[model samples]
Target: MKKFTITRILMLLGLFLISSGIHSTNKESIFDNIFTVMERTSSAGNLPGIIDNAGANRGAGFNGRYVFVASRQSGDYVYYWDVTNPDAPVQELNISGIGGGTFTLADLTAIGNHVFASNMVMPGIFKIYHWNGIGAQPSVLIEYDSGTARLGDAFTVMGDPDDFAMIIVSQHGGKSFYVWAMENGELNFDEPLVVTIDDLPANANFSRVTLPDGEDEFPVVSGPAGVFVLGEDEDIILTIEQSFFPGWPMYVNIFAYEGGRYFAFMHVKDNPAANVMYVLDITEGEDVLEALQILKNGTFAAKVLHSHDMGSIANGNASVSMDVVIDSFGNLWLMGFAAGNGFVVQRIGDAGPDGLLLPFMETFDGEGEDTPDTWLPEGWISFTLDDDGEEFNWYWSPGPSANPNGQMRSQSAYQDDGTWYVLNPDNWLVTPQIYMSEISGDEIIELSFKIGTGAQTPGFK
Candidate 1:
């Protein structure tokens, strides 16, 4: 047997320690081989209109499925797509109601075999669908009667619809906070549960549901531009710490349901121009519940010279904007304009808020700006797979800049399958390229990407 010197053994141990840290990041790498591409395949076919916020219902245990707002040309209704098989997903249902008037609604959620959706328009409405579980056809149930004032624009349905305390959050005039619930499919309109706040409107630029309250709690908050949930059933209520303050932040809020009390987190920042994210803690007066935070990255569109504008459009429409998406793993993925430079993804770890972290991430130019050169970026990102903790597979989405030939390469330590793949789209397409690989476990790892500018392409290879 070959022996190692003392120095060599120490080096091996050092490397082992570093690898251990990487393993600690994830117990089992969820992304083994499943890939999601963000192509501009909007079923609605319309760019998202100006709205504070919208999202699919989480109550419907349909995690890992694509549920987003969609509209039809024939009539106004929200559409749901069974995107589990993303490569060839099929529309499962067309949700509509009386008169079939078009609605600007959020996506649907699944509860057992039932799905729920909401329309935040005035006189907001909610639609329920029952799935037999055998087929994709979703049977429409009678709309839940939300006894809210006819001053709706930005609202959301909280809690499971099948439950007795199915609630709806209604904001009228950006000041009034109304909570309504349906019992036996009938709405109790006369008993208007109002949340009183000092000075603010009925609606603001942003809102969200953090918790679903119990039978007695009716807590809520409204402010110039912040909100948070107070409590839920026996869950802790979040109290506003005097130390926690919002200094002219754009839009931030928290919502929760606890012990008949609806907690709202509202950060009142005095400076209108100051933009920052504030963190809040939820507790039951004494016992700390959980750590929650609201980050606001508002954008201000600026007018550039006609020549510069044209150049920007020609060079891939670089206006410098940012957006955030919370992934299945509860990771907040932030992308877009970076300072006076390009763009990057801001990664946040599962730790307390005080120790905020920021890395150089990445920087790119107009590398994969156009078709034929828009699938992968050069030295942009690399992916790998872990099988039984023994061998790993690695691959990189190829870019024209890295390999002008526009190709991708993949390799595995255990398998010798020399296969390289490429998928391309023409024009200013804005869909992420997805890739999948199989490991020892039954689960497959997936990678979803939106590559922008650099010496590489902009999609998956």
Candidate 2:
């Protein structure tokens, strides 16, 4: 036997391997043949550049080049990081001394050069600080002591970066939502604009909304609806109510206001009746409908979309709404959970089957299913190669190493030479859209028996 090491053998075979490559190296770009690994430097496992401590990081927002971190109410420090080199992040500053009393921390958001911190304790004031993007610490610009309405839990900074607006949902024992405008180094109003159901555009569609079982006495009116403003004009709102009605044990209502009309985009009445309100009067029919209702503007009726569950996983039960984000293009991104899959994200724009979406462009966290495939977290298909309308072997999979039995993968996958393979992209799993039939008044909408897409509703559900 000849004396040879593994290194020598690999070096000698390199030429032969290149000669018989899978794709032609002559035509392919360098990027096509290269793979890059992202090395993360974090104070915690999930959040890079954040300190791993006992207190949870409540709120985080970006202002130009800095990433600010706001700790929970118990935490005494608020920090920022310089992410000029994302691969290796550097802690820039840590700020404490917030809240008028002890044990009261802050939640933060930034608009241009201003960082706004809201604390519910004492002064019950929202503080705005000057962030010049040149220094590590922020200077207190102004503080608005809005009576006793504590801008506590949830808030979002919206509109253009230079002249932005904030929607702060306060929970000072009673819930309230407020919109505050900001520009240059000041606030445009003495107080934030309060959002109310009365402010919603009056339309005929409100009469058509129905709750779970049938019993309805106008569900509980909670304060401060989850609110988000799109651009300078459109405002979106989500509200949830606790109900005793079997048909709608809980109701999630999504409303949007644009061009003088408030459209009810979705009303997901959770039919988890037996789980919450046990009533013997509802013995005639099914227990859970858990359906999604979608509506279009100027339309009088809403369509009850399909019903499906991601089931329970190790992490617990998941819903059609897990998380939501808006892209720079202004399209909404919906994230839902799956039992076997970690998270599934989808974009919502132009209505699929329901004529509800105004051509917009549109993921997940859910529990596992009753009979989840292979106990694997990742499944589904990803497109690889595309040549105009036609494609070749577009399905991308982790192969035998990551998914030996091809768990949670598509039914279109097949076995080849003892290894599971994904040869077809036609049957790739995508979020289901509402499609209407051409039959005029007899409108038939096709819903998914398994996979589906709906609102990543603003509610905490």
Candidate 3:
């Protein structure tokens, strides 16, 4: 017999036992449902006349009931709109005379009542302008001359303006980025910490960085190569490959809704049909690194909950700003800029209910007739790293006579036209999200499954 190996998975069962502790209520994740609430094209003429300039609108910021957009041309101005009614955003304020000179404005970020904007006055000099309110005059908060480094491609600020905050900025053509800290609402302009990321691509323009809410350790960076999740020590922990994006990832943001967290990004170049935005649920892992690893390597596309295409928008230089409002209910909103196109707004709906209930089971017996041989179980995802695309790593199989029900098996070896080939598969089988919140304190959770290998032979290793 030609020796080979076949790994079989019989069934997966989750058994739950009742505990005496009280069952706490859980809020649903907002990323589960997403819908576009409003989108304004540049041709709509609803924005200021300066917005019509090519590659003008760049960065976006959200503070209270107002949304701020920065334009780079005509006159370096920041425009504010009253989005109390998101559908009808009334243009309100036009901030001009920033830096007291004509410079190219790049990006804008806001936290609470404070808004900050960046401008690259020249190849080696940049300034970060700050404003306390809509009526306040902007001032140069941090001015730096890097000699030869192109500064202020994109940046973000996190935390409260009246309290502590941190700002992250990217060098347009350099291998490193810069960070500054705020102590008691004052920026530390003496010296900014410079971090050089290894393996960062050369000449990668339009780089953007963002730190997750309440997370001061990990900062997610996006560039032409891909999206990298940096550890507290500035080491690259996880990377979402560029192949997963429709174009170069221009912006990335992490937001928390209810008790769950999500990752969102937009491409620098828009697809022919529209500019796309992707969101992945990263709530399972204990921390951001583990959650991203699970989403990138393990669960794969199973956790990608949303991908919205804003129609025919030209994202000259894309940017995304997220905010939440709570009145009688919680509302999560995303404000984005489509360079040549106008502003786009989207809302993520509540996740309705939590994930699957306890005592769940999957037998892999429901193979559809359309693909009887390679059918996958519902809610189960399978992916392979093989570039050939000719073979699947896992498939449905009819078991032996003694166990004829069905089985999920991996492809280890096969023969084609009398030529025997040994297969090495890099693949993953990911289960759907399971809600474990019901388990009370000190309660033990158990995972059990049966696995066996078919075709045992001495020659097979």
Candidate 4:
């Protein structure tokens, strides 16, 4: 009787362990094919020629080549940088003579060669300063003095400035927002269209008001409670609960890349370590509503494509601005700036589902022993979580003493003249996206691979 009882307990324990392992794997696999990774390419703070005003950096804007950063003080200046080589950004221009009356320059947004900055000169008196391009003299595009509404806490511009553009600005600490239209380089300063949202948290200052180009009908706003999509009737069409966010949502934007549409936002909290920037793939839906609906239903864990730890770089009000730019080489990049944290540039990888045909195989047949160390087969990715810069990644290796054809290989560490040098290999090699749509309900799939190591000591996992 005792032996039988012990055996039963052991069996139950084994089953529980197996169940836990399966659950963990399933949770991880859900994000495997849906999200991309935000690899930080460059970041710098307090560089020469750039203002180093901590906690005063209010906003940033990108016009293809240049990234403009503005300080939120009466006499502070707006600086621009040329990040052609993200690794080494060069400060190009700085404009002064901004800010007056009650508030200084609060935020900025750029489209094409045109840049716009906002300032609330006095109570209910808001002015938008326009620049044709960097180094161009600023002109007052629109000045409205009405009610007790406050503008310029956060704003965004949609459409092409060369053709037609619409500027959306939020009333600070209020539920109402204002919009203006510009066509053929002419501004219509006529009475602005004011839309008021219902159930907006009291004293909730909008951190961002984004209207994706050509999607003016559905505008998105980020505030204290969460991020919301406002419909034509000023109703909250969709809501991304604040609980889903890592911190208070401060900035949000949408962009398209590699035939995929993505939504990204930066959040902040009292603990700077809690701050993070997240990106999600919205390409599964045909339209904005459909994409957002999928995201709302899928929950945060399932839809998040990427997350970058902001660390202690941002805190306090944590006013941040982000913009997406496509380089001349057609690579997509996300540029971000926080008042006290400076700026960061990350290259957006193509991690969306490719829906490639089934039975995919990568034999690494074309690789030779002499292949360049940095070469990687198309669609394959290699990266390391550590910033130590010892990126000794997996490379093509001609098999030893067996098959002549090459195979992918990685070395844990190396010994030089009796001295053991630890590489501390914390790396990942990801395969290309594969289609899994054929797997139906209750279907089982298998992934098989051959892995071996030349060393006697254990390394590969």
lDDT for model 3 comes to 0.57
Number of the candidate with higher TM-score, 1 or 2: 1
Taking the tens digit of each residue's C-alpha lDDT, what string does model 3 give over 1-461?
A: 42110000001111112221222123233444555555565434454455645366677776645677787666567877655355443553435556532245877877777888888643655778888877787777887776677777577675556755667777766777777767666785646777677666554366766665545356677776788876545667778787766676656776666667677776556455345556667776666666677777754467567765543545554444444433223556776655555666666543322622222222232222232334334434433223454444343222222223443443333345755454443223334435545677889654432212331111110
Candidate with top TM-score is 3
TM-score of each: 0.36, 0.36, 0.62, 0.61
Candidate 1: tens digits of C-alpha lDDT, residues 1-461: 53332123223433112111111122113222212322211121322231111222111123223333333233344433333233343344544332321243432333333444444444444443434342444454435444444322333343334443334343544434445554443444434455433333234323333222221232333233433334433121443322334322212222221111112221222223221222222322211122222111211111100000001111111112222334444443322221112122232333222332211122223322243333443333433223332333433444333445644432111224754444222212222233333446777554333344442333432
**lDDT (CA) for every model shown?**
0.31, 0.32, 0.57, 0.58
By how many angstroms RMSD does model 2 differ from the true structure?
24.6
* Candidates by lDDT, descending order: 4, 3, 2, 1
- Which of the predicted structures, 2 or 4, would earn the higher TM-score when compared with the native? 4
Error of 1 at 32 (Å): 15
State which candidate, 3 or 4, has the greater TM-score: 3
Compared with the true structure, model 1 gives a TM-score of 0.36
Pick by lDDT: 1 or 2, better one: 2
Give the lowest summed-lDDT range of ten residues in model 2. Answer: 273-282
Predicted structure 3, TM vs. truth: 0.62
For all candidates, what are the clash counts? 54, 29, 0, 0
